[model samples]
Target chain A: MKIYIHTKFQESIYQQFRDGLEPKYEVIFGDGEVSESLKEQFLTCDICYGNVPLDWLNTSSQLKWLQLNSTGLDPYQQLTEYQFQLTNLKGFFGQSVAETTLAGILAVYRRIDELTRLQTKNEWVGTPIRETLHLLHKAKVVILGSGAIGLKTKQLLSGFECKTTVLNSKTISQLADYLPTTDILIATLPETKETIGLINKTYLDMLKPSALFVNVGRGSAVDESALIEILKEEKILGAVLDVTEIEPLPTESPLWNLPNVLLTQHSSGGWAEESAEKVVFFLNNLAHFEKGEELVNNVDLVKGY
Target chain B: MKIYIHTKFQESIYQQFRDGLEPKYEVIFGDGEVSESLKEQFLTCDICYGNVPLDWLNTSSQLKWLQLNSTGLDPYQQLTEYQFQLTNLKGFFGQSVAETTLAGILAVYRRIDELTRLQTKNEWVGTPIRETLHLLHKAKVVILGSGAIGLKTKQLLSGFECKTTVLNSKTISQLADYLPTTDILIATLPETKETIGLINKTYLDMLKPSALFVNVGRGSAVDESALIEILKEEKILGAVLDVTEIEPLPTESPLWNLPNVLLTQHSSGGWAEESAEKVVFFLNNLAHFEKGEELVNNVDLVKGY
Candidate 1:
C-alpha cells in the first residue's frame, strides 16, 4: 500500500518515520504544501497521515484512512462527506495543552510577565511588587468544557489546591454563577455550534474584577471583541489566550499591546518532540489498520467533536 | 505586656493586627525602619512581631520573644547572643514560594518569556517556536533541601509527572549522581553555614546541557559566578533565580541581560494578602506566647535554618 505522509516534520523526524515502516510498503513524504505533485501522490495513496487538503480528500478514490496530527477537527468540519476513515490526535495533546494552560495562569498569578519586563529594563521593583502579586493556592477556578484538556487542566490545578469546577454542555448553564466567584476562568471548549460565542459579554461581565481568563481551546468559542472590551476596561484581571480569533494574529490587533494580555500564538499543544511522537502514534495506528481492527480516536464528522 | 510590631504592614493590616490583640496589652506599630523612636519602642516592648535591628535587640532587656515575618533566619545568624525566643515563618511561605517556582519553570519550558517578548513586538511567531518549547512532564528533577519550600515544590512537580529526587544535607552527597541525568535542578535550601555556596561550579557542571536550574531558597546557597558562567556559555538551558547573590542585583550584573534567565526579583513569596496573613500568624503566635506554650516555627539561630 502507498502511504503519503503530509505532516511537516523535521529532517530527523521524517527519517525516523520512514525507518519505522515495513520494507514492502511504498511511502512518499510531502513538503507540507499543496501542489500538483502532492495532489498526484495523494490520489494514489491507500493511507494518508496528517491534514491533507479537504478538497483533495473529497475527490480521492483510493485513500482508505486519513490521520490528523492535531486534536482539533475545525478544519475538517467543512468537509460534507468523505470515504476515508478519520482519526485525530485527541488525548495526545491533553498533557501538553493543559501544561501550557497552567503555565499561562501561573505566570499571571505570580506576575512573571511584569517581572520579565522588569528584567529586560534591569529594573528591580523588589518588595513593593509583592503587594500586587497573587497566589493560585486555594483559588476558586471555573473551567469550561469537560474534554481531555479541561480534565487535565483541572487535575493540574489540584496540585495548587485550586477549587475547580468544570462546565460542559450539560453544566454550561451554571457558568454564570461560577464566574462571579471564580479567581480563574479557563475555556477548553472545541469549536462547535453551541460553543461559538458562548463566552459573550454577559458571561465575561459576570466574572470578578480579579478573575484571570484563560483560553487554550478554540477561539471561536469566545466572543473576542467582548473579551477585549472587558480586558480594556479592566473588568477582569487579565487573559492568557493561546488561541485567538485569527492565526498569526494580525499585528494591528490590540491584543498584542494589551496591558495584561498574554498571547501564546496557539503554540500550547507543542513540545520539542511533537513531530516524532505523532509519527509513533501513526505507526501504531497503522498496525491496527493492517489487522483490520477499528482505529482509535475516530472522529464523527457530523458531530464535529 | 507590650508588643512592638516592627513589620511594615499596610494601614489596613495594622488595624487588623491591632484589632486582634487584647486591649490590656499595649501595641505600637513601627514604620519598618530603624529610628530612635523605633529603637525606643523595641527596647520597651515585651514581644516583637517583626525583624527589629539585631543591635537593638542585643540590649533590649524587656523583649521576651521575636516573631519574624520571614522564613529565613540569615539576618539573625550574626547575633552572638540574645534573650528573645526567636520564631520565623518557616512553613508560611511554602505554598506561595512553591507556586512561583513552578510558574518560573513552566514559563521557561513553555517559552512564555520568549512569547512575552514577542508579544511586546507584536510578533506572531507561529509553528516554528514549537520546536523550541518543552514539557515538564516525565522530566527527571533534582530538588535541593527538604524544607517546606523544597517539599512543596516536589508536591507541585508531581502533578506534571516529573520524576523528582529530593536531596537534603544527608543525601546531598548523591547530588552528583542525579545532576547528570536531571532535566530540572531546583535549590530550595536556606542560608546556613553548611548550605552556603552548595550549588557551586562542580554540581552545576554535572547537569545535562538541557537542564533548567531554579533557585527559590536563598542567594547564599548558590555560587552566582559559576551559575552566570554556565548560562553565558549556554552550558545549560536556562535559570529562574528568585534570589540572587546581590539583590536588587546591582545594575552591572549580567543576570539582568542573560538570554533565558528569569529574575523574579525576590517576589516569589508575595501574595495580595501577605501582610494580612502575617498579622494573623502573629496574632496566633501571640496566644501561644501568652500561654507559655511552645511557639511554632521556632528557629535555632546557631544552626541557622
Candidate 2:
C-alpha cells in the first residue's frame, strides 16, 4: 500500500509520520504545487493525506480515507457513501477560543477603545468609572452552542461566580428559561442548515440592556441588519465580533463605524504556534488511522460539528 | 452629638439617621459650608459629625469622634490627633478601582488606542496587532494590596482565567506567591508613608516583558521618574494610569506622547450616586458607635490601612 501526504509537513514530523507507517506502506510527499503529471502517483495511494479541498471531492480512485487537522468539519459535511471514514483535529482551539471570549467581554466592560482614543489626543481625562458591572458574578451569560469551544468558554467563566446557560438545538430542558435573563450572550454555533440566520430582531430583544454580545461563532448566525437596528436603538450594551459575513470588513462597512462595536480580524482562536501544531497533529492522526486504530475526532458527517 | 454633612446627602438617609440617633443625644444638623457662629454648635456636642477641617474639634471641647465619609485617611493621617476617634468609609470604591485596572490591562493587550486611531483614519490594523501579545488563558497577573479593591480586581480577572497573585504589607499566602511571575501588575495601594514610592524600577523589572501595568493607587505610590524611564525604553508593554505625580502631567512630559500609555482623570472610584450612599452608610455607623457599638471602619493611625 502507498500513503500520500498532500502538503509539505515539518521535517521532524514528516520523519515520525513516515516511520509510523513505513513497515506497512510506502509514504510519499506531494504539495498542492506538485505538477499534474506527478499527481498520477495519488492513484496508487491507499490513504489520501489532505484536507478536503474547497472546490470539491476529486480524490484519486485509490484514495480510501481522508484525514483532516482543522476542528471545523462543515466543509466535508456532504461526503458521499464512499465508505471512507473522515477524521478531524478537535479540542485544539478550546483554551485559545475561551481566552478570546474572556478578552472580548473585558474589552466591552472596560471601554478600552474609548479610553485609548482619548489617550492619542494627549488628553488625560480621568473620570470615575462605575464598578457596578465589574465582575461577571451573578450575571446571566447565554452561550448559543454546546460544542467544545463553547464548553471551554463556559468553564472559564464558571469560576467567576457567574451563571452560564447554553442554547443548543438538541432540545435539552435543563437549559430552558435560562436565555431571557442573560447579561451577556456569546455565540459559538456552527453555521449549518438549522443555524444560519438564527439570531433575529426578536431573538436579540430578549437580552437585557446591560448584556454584552460576542460572536466568535459563524457570522451567519447573527442578522447584521437586526444587529445594526438593535445597536442603533440601544437594545444591548455592546458587541465584540471576530467573524463577519464578509472577511476583511471593508472600510466602508457600516459595522466598522459603530461606537459600541469591537471589530477584530477573524482570529478567534489562532496563535503564533497553532498553525505549525495543527499541521503536525494532522499528520500523526493520519498515521494512527492507517494502523487500523480507533481514530480520535472522527467527524459525524450528519451533525457537521 | 451633631452630624455635619459637608456634601449633599440623600434626604431620606438624613431622616433615617436622625430617627435612629435622636432618642440618645442632641443632634445638630449643618453642612461644611455652615457659618462659623452656627457651626460653633459643636462646642456643646459630644460627638461632632464631620470629616477633616478641624474646626469641629476646635468648636467642641467635648468632641470624642469624627465620622468621615471618605475612603482614604491620608488627609487626616498626620493632621489629626488622639483627641477624637476617626472613622472612614472603606470598601466603597473596590469595584470602581477594580474595573479601572481591568480596563487598563485590556487596553494594552488589545492595542485599543492604536485600533481606534486606525478606525478614525479608516485604516485596518489587526495584522500588526496579531503580532503583539494576546489575552489568552495563560496570562499571569499580580496585584499589590489585596484589600477589598484588589480582591474585586481578582474576581474580574478570574473570569479571564488569569493566574492571579497578590502582595500586601501583611501576609497573603492564601493568594499566589509573594513575588511570582506576572504578565500584568495592578497597583491599588492607598496613599500612606509605607505605600509612597512602592512601585519603582526594581519592582517593575520583575514583570514579564510586554506585560501590561495598571495603577489605580495613589499618585505617589509610583516613582514617576522610574516609570517614565521604563516607558521611554519600551522595556514594559503598556500602562494606564488614573493618577500621576503631577496633575495634568505637564504638557512637556514625554508620557503624553508615549505609544502605549493612557492617562485618565483621577475620578476612578467616585460616581454620581456614591457620595449619597457613603453618607448613609457613615451615619448608620455613627448611630451604632453612639450606642457603644464597635466601630465598623475606625482608622488605625499606626497601620494606616
Candidate 3:
C-alpha cells in the first residue's frame, strides 16, 4: 500500500514520522504545497496524511483515508462527496489553545500589557497602577462551544475559581442572558453554518461594559466589523483575538493600534513540539487504520464540525 | 477606647473602617505618614490599624494592639521589645499574588510579551513565531516557601498539570536537586532572617537554561546582583520580578531594559477592592480584639514571619 505524507514539518519531524510507519509500505512525502508532481503522486496513494487538495481527493479513486492536520473543518464543510475516510486533529489542540486563552485573559486582568509597556520606558508606576489591576479569581466567565477546546478552558478556569458557563448549540440561546453579567466572554466555536456570524452586533452589545472578549475559534464565528466597531467605541473593555477576520490582519487594521486589544495572530494552538506531536497522532491513527479498525475524530461532513 | 487608623487607604476606605468600628470608640485617621499630629495620636491610642513607626510603638504605654496592613514583618523583625500585640495581614494576599505570579509565568510561556510587542508595531509574524511558543502544561516547577502565597501558587500551577515541588525551610535543603531539572522557579518567601538572600548565585546557577524565574516574595529573598548577572548573560530564559530590592528600581537598573524580564513593580497584591477588603479584614480583627479573643495572623517578632 502507498502512503502520501503532505505536512510542512521540520526535517526531524518528517524523519520521526517516516521511522514510525511500517517499512513494508511505499511512502511519498510532499512539502505541504500542491504542485503538478504532488497531484500526480497524491492520486496514486491509498492513504494520505495532512490536508491534500480537495479537488485531488475528489478525482482520486485509490485514496481510502485522509487525515487532516487541522481541527477546524471549515474548508471541507462544503464537500458533498468523497471516497476517503476523513479524520481531524480534534482533541490534540485542546490543552495548547486553552493555555493561550488563559494567558491572554490573565495578561489583560493582571495589567501585563501595561506593565510590559512600562518596562520598556523603565517607568515604575507602582502604587498608582494597583487600582487598575483585576483578578481572574471568582470571575464570571461565559465560554461558547462545548468542544474539546471549550471544555479544557472551563477546566483551567475552575482552578481560578471562575464561575464558567459553557454554551453550545443547546445552550446558545441563553448567551444573551449570560453576557450582561459575564466578566470574560470566550468563543471557541468551530466554523459551521450555525456558528458563522453568531456573535453579531446584537450579541456584542449585550456584553457588560467591563467584559473582556476572547476568540480562539474560527474568525467566521464572529462578525469582525461589529467587534471592531464596539471595541473602537469602548463598548466593551478589550479583546484577545487569536483568530481574526483575515490572516495577517491587514497591517492597517485598527486592532493593531487598539489600546487594550491583544492580537495573538492565530498562534494559540502552537508549542515547541506541535509538529512532532501531530506526526505521532497521525501515526497512531494510521496504525489503527492498517488494522481495519474505526478511526478516532471521524468528522461528520453533513454536521460540518 | 482610642483607635488610630494609620493606613494610606482612600477616603472611602477610611470611612468604611470608621463605620465598622463601635460608636463608643474614639477613632483618629492618619494619612499613613509619621507627622507630629500622627505621632501624638499614636502615643495615646489603645489600638492601631496599620504599621506605625517602631519608635512610637516602643514608647506608647497606652497601645494594646497593632494590626499591620502589610503581609511581611521585615521592619518589625528587628524590634527587641514592644508592649502591643502585633498582627500582620498574612494569607490575605494569597489569591492576588498567586494570580500575578501565574500571569507573569504564562505571559512568558505563551509569548504574550513578544505578541504584545508585535501588536504595537502592527507586525504579524504568525507561523514563524509558533516555534518560540511554549506551554505551562506538564512543566517541572519549584516553589520556595510554604506560606499562603507559595501554597496558592502551587494550587494554581496544578491546573496546568505542572509537577510542582514546594520547599519551605525544612525542605529547602533539597532545592539544589530540583533546580537542575526545573522549568519554572517561583519564590514566595517573606523577608525573614532565614529567607533573606536565599536564592543566591549558586542556587540560580543550578537552574536549567530554559528556566523561568518568578519572585512574588520579598526582593531580599534573592541576591539582586547575582540575578542581574545571570539574566544579563542569558543563563536563564527570563524572570518575573514583582518585588525588587529597591522601589521604583534605580533609573539606571538593567532590569528595566532586560530583554525578557517582566518587572511588575511590586503591584501583585493589588485588586480593584484591595483597600476596601483590607478595611474589612481590619474590622473583623478589631471585633476579635474587642472581645479579648486571640487575633488572627499574630506575628512573632523574634521568628520574623
Candidate 4:
C-alpha cells in the first residue's frame, strides 16, 4: 500500500510522519500544497493525508482513505458518493475551541474589552462599567450541537452553575423556542444543510435584551445581516463571533468596529502545537486503518457533520 | 436603639430596609457622605452600615457595630484597638471577584487583548497569534489566601483541570518553592503586616519565564516597583491586576503602556446590582445582630482580614 502526505506542517512534524510510516509502506512526501505536481501523486496513492478539492474525489479511484485536518466536514458533503473512507480531527479541537468560547463569553460578561480600551488610553474609569457588568454564574445557557465542542462547553460551564440545554438533531429544529429563556446562547454546529442559516431573525429576536449570543461554529449557521441589525439596535446584550460568513472579514465590515461585538478572526481552534497535534491524529488513524480496525472519528456520510 | 444607613442606595433598597426594621428600632437614613452632621449622629447611633474614617472608630463610643460593604478590611486595620464590633462583607464578594480573576486568566492565556487590538485595526492576521495561544487545561496553578476568594478561584479552575495548590497562612511562607513549576500564580491576600510587600523581587525572580501572575487581592500586598521592573524586563509572561497600590493609576505609569499588563481599575468587585446585593447583606447581618447572635463575617481584629 502507498500513502501520500500532502499537508503543510513544521519540519519536526513532517519528520515524525516520515519516521513513523516510512518503514512499512511506500511513502511519498509532497510539498504540502495542493499544487499540480501534488495532484498527480494523488492519482496513484492508496491513501492520502489532508483535504483535497471536491473535484479530485471524482478522479482519484485509487484512493482508499483520506484524513482531514479540520473538524468541520461540511465542504466534503458533495463527495459522499465516492468510495474513499473519510475521518476528521474532531476530539482534538474541542478543548482549544471551548476555551476560546469561554474566554469570549467571560470577556464580554466582565467588560474586559471596555477595560482594555481604557488601559490603552491610560484612563482609569470605574463606575460606568457596573451598568453593563454581568456574571456567567446561574445563566440559562443553550448550546447547539451536542458533539465534542458542545459537551466540553457544558463541562466547562458546570463550574459556573449555568443551566445548559444542548440542541442536537432532535432538538435543533425548535431552537427559536429556547432563545426566549436563554441568558447565553452558544452555537457550535457545523455548516450542514440542517444547520445553515438556522439562527435567523426570528430566533435572534426571541433572545432577552440582556442575553449574549456566541458562535464558535461555522458562520454560515447564522444570518450575518440579521445579527448585525439586532446588534445595531442593541436588541441583545452582545455577540462573540469566532467565525463569520466570510473569511478575513472585509475591512469595511461593521463587526470590526462594533462596540458590542468581539471578533476573534477565526482563530478559536488555534493552539501552539496545532500542526504536531494534527499529524499525530492522522498517524493514529492510519495505524487503525492498517490494522483493519474501526477508525476514531470516522465521518457519517449522511449526517455530514 | 438607632441604626444609621451611611451608604448610597436605591430608594427601593431603602424601602426594603424600612419594611424590614422600622417599628422596633429608630432607623435614620443619613446622606451617604460622612459629613459633620453624620459624624454627630454616629456618636449617638447604636449601629452603622458603610465605611467611615478610621478616626470615627476612636470618637464614636456609642457605636456598637460597624458593617462594611467591602471584603478588604485593610483600611480599617488601624482602628483595631477600638472597643466596637467590625464586620466586613467577606464571603459575599467571592463569586464576583473569582469571576473577574478567571476572566483575567483566560484573557491572558487566549490573548483576548491582542485579538481585540487586532480587531480595532481591522486586521485578520492569524499565524502570529498561535505562538502565544494556550489552554487553561493542565496548568500548574497556585492560589494565595485560602479564604473564600482563593477557594472559589480554585473551584472555578478545577473545570479546566489545572493542578491547584492554595497557600494560606500555613503554606504562604514557602510559596517561593512552588514558583519554579507554577504556570499560574494568583494572589488574593488582604493587606496585613506579613502579607504587605510579600510578592516582592525575591519571589518574582523564582517564577518561570512563561508564568502568569495575577493580583485580585490588595495592591499593597505586592511591591509595585519590583513587579514593574520584572514586567519591563519581560522576566515573566504577564500580569492581571484588579487592585494597584495607588489606584486611578496615574497616567504616567508604565503599566498602562506595557504589552504584558492588564489593568482592570478595581472593577473586580463591580456588578450590575452591587448596591442591592450589599444592602441585602447588611439587612441579613442586621437580623443576626438583633437576635444577639454573632454577626456573619465578623473581622478578627488581630489578623485584620
Candidate 5:
C-alpha cells in the first residue's frame, strides 16, 4: 500500500512515523500543499494525511482517506462535497489549548504583562492593586462551543468554582443574554459559515467593562476590527487571544501594541511532545485502517465539525 | 471603651466603622507606626487594629487586643513577648493569593512574558513551542504551608488533575524527598525562626531542572541571595515571587533583569474589595469584643501563625 504523509513536523518525528510503518507499506512524506510530485503521490496512494488542496479532492480515484493535522475542519469544508472518508486530529489538542486558555486569562487578570513591562524598565512601582487585581473564583464564564476544547475549559474552571455556561450551534442564539453577565467570555468555536464573524460589535457591546474576551479556536469566528477598536478605547477590561483573524498577525496591527490585549501568536495548541504524540496517533490509526477497523476521530462531514 | 484603627482605608469605610460603633466607644484612626500621638492613643485604647511597635506592647496597661491587617505574623514575631489577644486576618487573602500563584505559574510555563516581549516589538513570531509550551495538567505540584492559601492552591490544582501535595510544619521535614520529584513547588509559609531562609541553596538544589518555584507567602522564608544566584545562572527553571524580602523590590535587584524571574511586587494579596472585607471583619470583631464574645481568627501568639 502507498501512504502519503503531508504533515509538517520535525525530521525525527517523521523518521519515527516512517520506522513504525515497517516494510509492509510504502510511505511518501511531503508538505500539506500538493505540488506536482505530491499530486503524483496523492493519485496512487491509498491514504493521504494532512491538508490537501480543496480542488484536488476529485483528482484521484485511489485516495481512500485524508487525515487532517489540525482539529479545525474549515480548510476542508469541501469534504462534504466529495465522497472520501475524512478524519481529523481531535481530542489531542483539547488539553493543550485548554491550558493555554487558562494561561492567557490568568495572565491578563493578574496584570502579568504590565509587570513584565515594569521589570524591563527596572521600575519598582506596583500596579494599582485595587483597580487591577482580579480573582478567578466564582467568576461568570461563558464558553462558546461545546466541543472538546470548550468542555475541557469548563472542567478546568470547575476548580475555581466559576459558573460556566457552554453555548453550541443550537443555543448560540442566546449568546446576547449571556454576554451581559459574563466576566469571562471564551470562544472555542471553530470557523464555519455560521460561526464566521459571530463576535461582531453587537456581541462585543453586550459585555461589561470588566469582562475579558478569550479566543483559542479560530480567528475567522471573531470580527477582529471591532475587537481592536474596543480594546483601543479601553471599552472592556482586556482580551487574551491565541487566535486572531490572521496568522502571524500583521506587524502593524493595533492588537500588538494594546496594553490590555495579550497576543500568543497562535501558539496555544503547542507543547514539546506534540509532534511525538501525533506520530503515535497516526501510526495507531494506520494500523486500524489496515485491519479494516473504523478509524478514530472520523468526523461527520455534513456537520462540518 | 477606646479603639484605635492603625490601617488606612477608604473614607466611606471609616465612616461606616465610626457609625457602627455608637457613643459607648471612642475610635481613633491612625497609621501602622507607633508615633507619639498614636502611643498616647494606644495607652488608653483597649483594642487596636494594625501594626504596633514591638517595644510598646508592654507600655499599654489597658491593651487587651491587637488586630492585624495581614496574614503573615513575621513582622510581629515579638507579639509573643507580651500577653495580649492577637487576631490577624487569616483566610481572606487565600483566594486572591492562590489565584495569583496560579497566574504566575501558568504565565511562566506558557512563556507569557516572552510572548509579551515579542508583542512589544511587534514581532509576529511565537517562541519555540518545542522548548517552552507546557501543560499544567498532570504536573507534580508540592505546596508548602498548608494554611488557607496552600490548601486553596491544592483545591485549584485539582481541576487540572495535577498531583498536589501540601506540606505543613509537621511534615516539612520530608520536603527533601518531595522537592526532588516536584514539577512545581509553591511556598505559602509565613515567616518564623524555623521558616526564615528555609529555601536555601540546599533545598533549591534538590528540585528538578524544570521545576518552578513560587512564593506567595512572606519573603523572609526564602533566602533571596541564593534564589538570585540560581536564577542568574539559569540553574533551575525560574521563580514567580509576589513577595520579596523588600517591598518595591529595590531597583538594583537582579531579579528585575533576570528573564526567568517574574516579580509581582507583593500585589498577590490585593483585590478591589479587600478593604471592604477587612472593614467588615474589624466591625464584626469589635461587636464580638463589645458583647464579651471571643473573636474569630484569634491567633495563639506562641505558634506565631
Candidate 6:
C-alpha cells in the first residue's frame, strides 16, 4: 500500500503513524507543483490526506480515503463530487471548539462586546443589568450537533451552573430532552445536507426570548439572513458567530451592523498541527484497515460522522 | 434587635433571607435620604448593616459592629480613622466574580477585542485563525488572591481540563497543590493597603510570555503603570481589566491604546437585583448579629479576608 501526506505539521505526527504500518506501506510527501495540480500523478497511491477543499481535489481515483484535517464537512459535503471516501478530523478539536463555545457564551453574558466599545470610547457604563448578568447561572443551553465537540461543550457548561442540551440530525430523543429548555443555543455541528440552513426563523423561535446563540461549527448551519432578522427583531439576546455562511461576511451584510450580534472570523480551531494529528490518527488506522483490522474513528462516508 | 439597613438591596433580599434565618429580626430600610446621617440614625441600634465608609460614621458612638456589602475593604480599610466593629461581604459574590474573571480570561484569550473591532470594519478573521485556535486544556492559569472569587474561578477552570494555580498575600502550602503552571493570571483581590499594586513588574515577571492577565476585583490591585510597562514591552500576550485605579481609564493613557489590552468599566459585579440581594443577605445577617447571634460572613479587619 502507498500513502501521501500534504499539510504543514510536525513530521513526527506522520512518522508516528507510518511506523505502525511498517514495510507493508510506502509513504510519500505531497508538497509541490506535481502534487496539487495533477492528481493523475498520484494515481498509484492507495490513500491521501490533506485539508484540500473539493475544488482543489484535481482527481481522487485509487484514493481509498480522503482524511480532512477539520471537523466540519462544509468543504466536502457533496461526497459524490469526490471519488474517494471522506472522513473528518472530528474528535481532536472537541476541547478547543468546546472552549471557544463557552468563550462565546461568556462573551455575550458578560457583555464583552459592550465593554470593549466603551473602552475605545473612554466611557464608563457600569450599571448592573440583572437581565444580562443572570444568564450564566440559570441559562438553558442548546447545543446543535451532538458530536464530540457539542457534548464536550455541554459538559463544560453543565459545570457553570447552566441547563444544557443538544440538537442532531436524527431526533436523538436523548438529545431532545436537553433542547426545549435551552436558553442559550450553541452550534457545534458539522455542515451536512440536512444541517445547512437549519437555523431558520422557525428554529430560532424554539429558543427562549433572551436566549444567547453562538456558532463555532459551520456558517452554512445557520441562515444568515434569518439570524439578522432575529437580532433586529430582538428575538434572541444576540449571536456570536465564529463561522458564517460566507467567509469575510460581506461589508454590506446586516450582521456587521447589528448591535446585538457578535461576529468573529471563525478563528476557533487550534493552529494547524493540532488538527493534522487528528487526521493522521485516522489515516494510520486505514493502513491496518487494509490488513483486516478494526478502526478507531472510522467515519462511515455514506452516513457521515 | 434593631438594625439599620443602608444598602438598596435591603428590602427584597431581607425578605428572602428572613425565611432562612432566625425569626424576630426587624429589618430597617435605610437606602434613602433621611434627615439623619448613618451615625445619627443608627446610634440607637446595636449593629448597623451598610457599606458605610468610616467617614460617614465619624460622629457615631454606638456602632458595635458594621457589616459591609462588598468583598473589598478599601472603602473600610481606613476605618482606624473612626471606631466601629467591622465585617465585610466577602464570599457572597464568589459565583458572580468568578464568572466575571473567567469572562475576562476568555475575552482576552479568544480575542473578543479584535472581533468587536472587525465587526465595525466588516472583517472575518475567525476563519483564517481557526487553524491556530487556542484550547484552554492543559493551559497554565494563575489566579491572584485565593479568596472566595479566586477559589470559585479555580473550580470552574478545573472542569475545563486546564492547569490552575493561585497566588495570594501569603503562600498557602495547601493551595499550592491546586495551582496550575500559570498560563494566565486572574486577579480577584480588593484594592487595600496590602493588595494595592500587587501585580507589579516584579510579580508579572514570574509569568510565561504567552500568559494573559485578567482583573475583576479592584483596579488598584494591579499597578496600572507596571501593566503599561509590561504591555509596552510585550511581556505577555494580552490583558483584561474591569477596574482601573481611575474609573473610565484616561483616554490619554497608553494602556487604553494597547492592541492586546481590554478595559471594561467595573460592571462585573453590578448585576442589579441579585447584587442587591447579596447585599441584603449581609444586612439581615447583621440584624441577627445585633440580636446576639453568630454573624454570617463577618470580616476579620485584621486578617483582611
List ranges where model 6 is wrong by over 4 Å: A1-37, A51-60, A74-86, A127-132, A167-181, A272-296, B1-48, B62-65, B80-85, B167-181, B191-194, B279-283, B286-291
- Stretches of candidate 5 above 4 Å error? A31-34, A79-83, A127-131, B31-34, B79-83, B127-131
Name the 10 consecutive residues with the lowest summed lDDT in model 4 chain A.
Answer: A29-38
Model 4, B1-305: lDDT tens per residue?
99888877778878877877758788778757877887888778999988777777788889889998677775676664777788998888788889999999889888899999888888998656775788888899999999888998998887788899999988887798899999999999977788889998899889989999999999988989999999999999999999888887888999999999998888888888877778778888888988899999898777665
Query: By descending TM-score, how would the candidates be arranged?
Result: 1, 3, 4, 5, 6, 2
Model 1 spans with C-alpha error above 4 angstroms: none
Give model 1's docking category. Answer: high
Compose the digit string of candidate 3's lDDT tens values, residues A59-170: 8999899899899775777688887899999988999899999999989989999999888888889988889889898999999989999999998887788899999999
Clashing pairs in 1: none
Q: Cα lDDT for residue A175, model 6? A: 43
Q: Each model's fnat?
A: 0.83, 0.38, 0.78, 0.72, 0.79, 0.63
Clashes of each: 0, 4, 0, 0, 0, 22
TM-score of chain A of each: 0.98, 0.83, 0.97, 0.94, 0.94, 0.78
Please give the DockQ score of every candidate, comma-separated: 0.86, 0.35, 0.82, 0.76, 0.71, 0.51
How would you encode candidate 4's per-residue C-alpha lDDT over A1-305 as one tens digit per residue? 88887766677877888777757588777656666777788788998887777777788889989888777775687764878888888878898889999999999999998899889899889766764688888899999999888999998898888899999989877777788889999999888777889988888989999989999999999999999999999999999999999887999999998899998878888888788778778788887998899998888778664
Residue-by-residue lDDT tens digits, candidate 1, B5-37: 887877898789778988999989886888987
User: Residue-wise lDDT of candidate 2 within B1-305, one digit each (tens)?
Assistant: 35444443457656755666656566666654556665566565656555636545544557677777667775566654567677777787787667656656655565555555676666665544554536536577778887888899887777566778778888534234433366777888888777888777777766655667788888798888888888888878777887788876677778788886877556567554565566567767876875788787888877775
lDDT of each: 0.89, 0.68, 0.89, 0.86, 0.85, 0.69
- Model 6 lDDT tens row, A43-155: 66777666654555645567776666556565454556556656667687777767777777787877888878877776666654433565387667777778888888877
In the range B201-277, model 5's lDDT, one tens digit per residue, is: 89997888888999998888898998898888887899999989988788888888999999888888887777777
Q: TM-scores across all candidates?
A: 0.98, 0.81, 0.97, 0.95, 0.95, 0.83
Worst 10 residues of 6 chain B by lDDT: B172-181
Model 3 residue B148 distance off true place after TM-score fit, in angstroms: 0.7
User: Whose DockQ is greatest here?
Assistant: 1
| Candidate 3 backbone collisions, by pair | none
Fraction of the native A-B contacts that model 4 recovers: 0.72
For model 1, residues A1-305, the per-residue Cα lDDT tens digits are 99998987778987887799999789888968899888988899999988888888878999899998888885789889788899999889898899999999989989988899888899999999998888888899999989899999988887788888998899898887787898999999888889888899888988888999999988888899999999999988999999988887998899999988999899999999888888889999999999999998989899786
Candidate 3 off by > 4 Å: none
Query: Could you tell me which 10 consecutive residues in candidate 4 chain B have the lowest summed lDDT?
Result: B74-83
Q: Select the stronger candidate by lDDT from 2 and 5.
A: 5
